[model samples]
Target: MNLSGVFYLGWRYLVRNRIKTLLLVAAFSLVWLLPSGLALVVSKIESQLRVRAAGTPLLLGQAGSPLELVFNGLYFTKPGIATFSFGETEAIDESGLATVIPLYARFSVGGGGGGKYRIIGTTLDYFDFRGLELREGRGLIDLGECVVGSKFADANGIGPGDAIISSPETLFDLAGVYPLKMHVVGVLSPSGSPDDQAIFVDLKTTWIIEGLGHGHEDAEKLGNDARLPVSAEDRAAAGETGGEIRLNASVVQFNEVTDENADDFHFHGELSDYPVMAAIVVPTDAKGQAILKGRYGRPGGLQLVAPSEEMDELFATVFSVQDLVLGLLGATGVGTLAIGALVFLLSNRLRRAEFRHLLHLGAAPGAVRALILFEACFVVLSSLVLSVVGLLAIDRFAPVLVRSFFG
Candidate 1:
């Protein structure tokens, strides 16, 4: 085959009808980018969910539905009952069964416009158990401090000392809402999981912000036993008269009180009356977990959950169908590309005369055949290049796409 003749015919074919070439590039690029981009997003979401679920053992919440608690607590995607008492958690640990870690999630991060960011309420052990590292200062230590995930920090322009606000009770609803501001005590290193888009704070703070940790609006009146609507001074006086003065529900948490009154004060509520969302248990041993599960089944305030089992079932049902549809769309794309190939094959028929003329001008049949092959090669290669370039641009501007569709 003559290389010079091939180049000449390829150049002629490309230059003769620029519009036709551009249309071919545009059509193939669309087909390439659509499937590729969807595949990219699906892969990302699946990978992120798996990463987030790796270390967790079980999630215990209300008995209404297992899937709701799993989604709400783990993925932060479902809304359901939000109270599992501290007493219930204690029973699991005391029953010589599972080592429980409580999860009481009831908030969201500030709006950076990508759905509601996950705001998880947990203990210090959560960071350790989940294998998360501190990015800047330190993890949540005091009640009011919070930690932001890397994506949360980067997207919202947050850092140490920056303020993170608790979004409303409703994820998408914003009516009669009072903002609760939490200070950024630390930033967490990115784990490429949902944590990167989550806000972590002490469980106490989560309850406190939502008026759940302790109920009454006024802390001054919290210590009072009079549920009959008495003020602080009256309650304090009543405490003196009421003898033995059991702690009121409103006043579960107190600080800086004297050591003498410490037992009677500061976090002094019957564990049963206190509200909780859910408990995450890490079983001390397999035998212990089995015994613990039997005990937990009877508790009124809590229910034990197997996070992994429920998650797998839910995702399998939902994503399996999604995978099927995506597979069909991908197949359709292949068929369309097949048709594009057929179109190119037929288009070559029009150039047969030209190739014959080249062959007549002392050109070998192999040279003319190579020129035809090069022209076809140009169509496929140019379309693929354009497609790659467009998808890369989409990846680079992903934040914009997220905001437009989800925010």
Candidate 2:
């Protein structure tokens, strides 16, 4: 019996029953693709999480979940995590054991239907620590100035000289936490990390958004209508018992800082007492890292953690869950293959009359067996090819999908 002739006859039979052939191919392809596709996505997520976590040596934040601190500091996520006083960072810096870079990422710009972008309040040290470079304009030099990430700038079509406004924490902010308009001074180069989606600004700029600091018009320039009544005793303490003190709605609080009024901005409280969501601690040497770790080991108010270790623990749990899911998928795939085999067996049984007629018309028994084998191989091989093509498409798009999701 000619092997090519057997294959050609089998192909013709399959083409005659094209719907069954297509269904079997699709089912078998899914059986192979599901588990493999999931594994690829998990691998991509693990790599993306590990890259930034490994780069950061340590994270300091309010005593809570170590994972939350890691996400907040490294990825600018977990915006609702508790914050520690900026004084804690100052104290850590004074120890001379590590370089402290404070991060205040509680605020965001745009929301509702506009899409929210994280406003990362950090020092110049953060840029250096992350090895970020500017692609346009210059670094932040004044209040309300910002440097946007590459992804954010590109998505919004914003560059130097454009502006971004902070989104209010709530619609009914009774404490007067209004949105602040910030000038975009620069855009960072793409780093393929979470920083690519953040908006970097001075720490004080975040404070201004929180109502901890503000700029206002000079009180003396306000007219009498804007001024509120002042007590005589209060006026006497000011060494001015003569004119009414302007201390009310008459004085306009600036929502945006310009070069002329930048100097007028001031904080309501001590700079050290301001809130920071987390801080990145970079030690000078191994010994310094040990010392800093030991110092914060007995923490009550604050906690020091290794981001890499936290990530390991997180992925450990994720992998355990992934293994369980993959096992389930494997079992399902086996069941699918069994059903496919049953379908082939039944199809052969239904074609028994045809096979018997071929045998009567001078065909050998071995030829009939070969025809069945060819049909089975065709289905299996076609499914395998389709599975491989699907995996390749997923591999190509996984990174972009993961980045967009995380960002």
For residues 1-407, what per-residue lDDT tens digits would candidate 2 score against the true structure?
Answer: 87887888898999999999999999999999999999999999888888888899999998989998998888776899998899999987998889999999998877821336899999999999999999999998999999999999999999999998988877787887678999999999999888889999999999998889998877787776778777788778988857656677546678999999998899976899899999999998899999988888885878999999998999999999999999999999999999999999999999999999998988889999999998888888899999999999989999888887665
TM-scores across all candidates?
0.70, 0.94
Q: How many backbone collisions does model 1 have? A: 3
Model 1 segments more than 4 A misplaced:
26-41, 79-82, 111-118, 138-141, 154-165, 168-178, 213-271, 293-303, 383-407
Alpha-carbon deviation at 192 in model 1, angstroms: 3.4
CA error at residue 171 for candidate 1, angstroms: 13
User: Where does the lowest 10-residue lDDT sum fall in candidate 2?
Assistant: 108-117
